[model samples]
Target: MERTERFCRIEMLIRSRGCVSFADLMTELGVSRATLKRDLDHLRTRMDAAIVYDRDRNGYRFAVTGRQARRPGPPEASGVWFSEREIHALLTMHQLLDGLGVGSSMGRHLQPVLERLQGMLGTSDSEARELVRRLRVVPPARKPVRGRSFERLAGAVLERRRLRLTIEADDGSGERDRIISPLRMIHDGGIWLLDAWCHESEALCRIPVPQVRAVQTLELRAREVPMRVIEAELDAMPALRAA
Candidate 1:
């Protein structure tokens, strides 16, 4: 694999596991000891990653959190570099998600990863958070979207596949599952809604991201909806035209 890809995997692995052994990283990345050490050293010294080797654990961990410091814009990029701007963007994103009361998947899983990345941008997590809070978004409704649900929806839309959604029904019916052919995602203020072809309803409907409890991927062989059909159905929705 390319060096950048390897670096990402390393970050992801370490983030998910809290630590990873040298042998485990080597086996997973399929790289020599020298290449691994070089990448780790570059991340620590150049990118200012807090990856530290714990002799007791015999692995690496980011080892820090909290935000406090002015974040400069990214410097010129060459390779394997994450800019301060990117970090700030994520900081802002997490802030928004928090206001929206997005669900546990993003709150529990993704936030720490972003927090760690923010900490890597040469600031405490709190400082990175301060940078995000500097710009405020008006308060948003609490919809409880799963952490990874938004990302999975985007992937489903890009791949033109069906998404199985566990969402709240609008009619006081509480939650139910709907298989949908997702076409578009609309961001209204701090809210995210999906426009899709609902198999159960046999029509287009708005699926709120925050209301989504889970998103499941389908097999490749599952029947896929044509984008043209989705567009046509979307065009026919009176609410869409009214907007």
Candidate 2:
């Protein structure tokens, strides 16, 4: 696992198990003794974690007191903890959003959040800027979009609204209109897809964004399906005939 994932996993293991032995941590993380020691040291020193070696139990555990400094609001609200690679991934996603042409207003809104992320990696503004400048994300060429439905579809998905769509049949059949509840939008294999609950067929369907000829957002709220149900359906038939 990557160091970021390992760090999160370590925190979870410690919290859930109360005290995790070195051998157990090593087995769970699948790292050598030296590497695990280094990770623990980094967590305690760099991350300001309240990890303490428990001699009584011969394991590591979070300190009972004085582990975390008193801060305003809840812990989730106050902290933005992330590793260097995760920050780079976020920056890359930011670039992807910019490339999607919705970045004008959104970028302005997200700029401060990105800056905060950068702050976690550096001590000063200049250092953060310098660190961010070192990484560049180059997105691959995507399939040419056929119509203006991309923006409307994205908005509908975010707003949890129903949609009236005119999609070109993949089998060379003419356009078909359908009412669907937008569940999620996915970008896969350089093409965008809308996964939704089709009202006509009463099933989940995938619609290629490029195949979308027309889109109309409805005022009615979209149907909500549990993620587990979606995953189960997806697993049963990896490929569902598109709408």
Candidate 3:
């Protein structure tokens, strides 16, 4: 089993059985003596898990509870513990969200999740913050989009609702309104494109999200299109071609 799985299993076994023998842990984890020992040490030192060997029972159990409840020990870690590899994965997620423009628009909504993961890491908050600060992601030049428009359009697509869009004419002729059924929102080459079925043209069209001057969600239900057809339309779009 994977290291993370083993860690979880070890905790579960200890919690369920009150105490678990070294041999039992090895058997349950399908690991060698040395590996089990390393895992226990990592749980104690790195994860701040208050696990202690019970000499009387000849087994291991949580120091915070069980028969030794009265005995004083180090405080148990408050939240879930993440392995080193998991910490790296969380850092990658943080960077990706910033790159995708979600941080500025949706940061407040997602801050709690981020904080929970950050707190669960096996490092101090300052260290985690320092690591995130050191690894900078410089995204390519991206077109600016109004957060409200993006949010409303995204909701309309998920809700299967139609939209009334005021799109800026390509030739500087001004804006025109089009009623469209949004199919999907595609982000490619630092631009957001709305894939929708145009009611006026009776065809699938890709609209640059930044070029949308105004947006309004309609009460009417959106028309559905097959996934294969959407893929074909996306393949033919000029924005998706090789630059």
Per residue, candidate 3 scores C-alpha lDDT tens digits across 1-243 of: 667667778888887787899999999889999999988987777666778999999999887766446656533333465665786787787787688665567667667766655544534678778878875677777887776677778889999999999988776688889999999987778878788999988888888888888988889999999989999767676653210
lDDT of each: 0.68, 0.75, 0.77
Q: Across residues 1-243, which tens digit of lDDT does each residue of candidate 1 receive?
A: 755566677888887787789999999999999999988886776555667898999998765543412333322222243555665676677766566545344555776576556545645557766766696656755445567787788778888788788876655578888788777886664567788777777766777686777888876423455668766776455553211
Question: What TM-score against the true fold does each predicted structure earn?
Answer: 0.49, 0.49, 0.62
Instruction: Evaluate candidate 1 by giving its C-alpha RMSD to the native, one decimal.
Output: 12.9
Q: Considering summed lDDT, which 10 consecutive residues are worst modelled in model 1?
A: 68-77
When 2 and 3 are scored with TM-score, the better candidate is 3
How far off is residue 9 in model 2, in Å?
33
Q: What RMSD value applies to candidate 2?
A: 10.5
Better model by TM-score: candidate 1 vs candidate 2: 2
lDDT of 3: 0.77
**lDDT-better candidate, 1 vs 2:** 2
Per-residue lDDT tens digits for candidate 2, residues 61-179, read: 87754324354322221234578777888877776775554445365568878866654453456776666566554546766665456667878988999999988888867999999
* C-alpha positional error of residue 117 in candidate 1 after TM-score superposition, expressed in Å: 4.2
Deviation (Å) of 81 in candidate 3? 7.4
Candidate 2 runs further than 4 Å off:
1-90, 98-134, 145-148
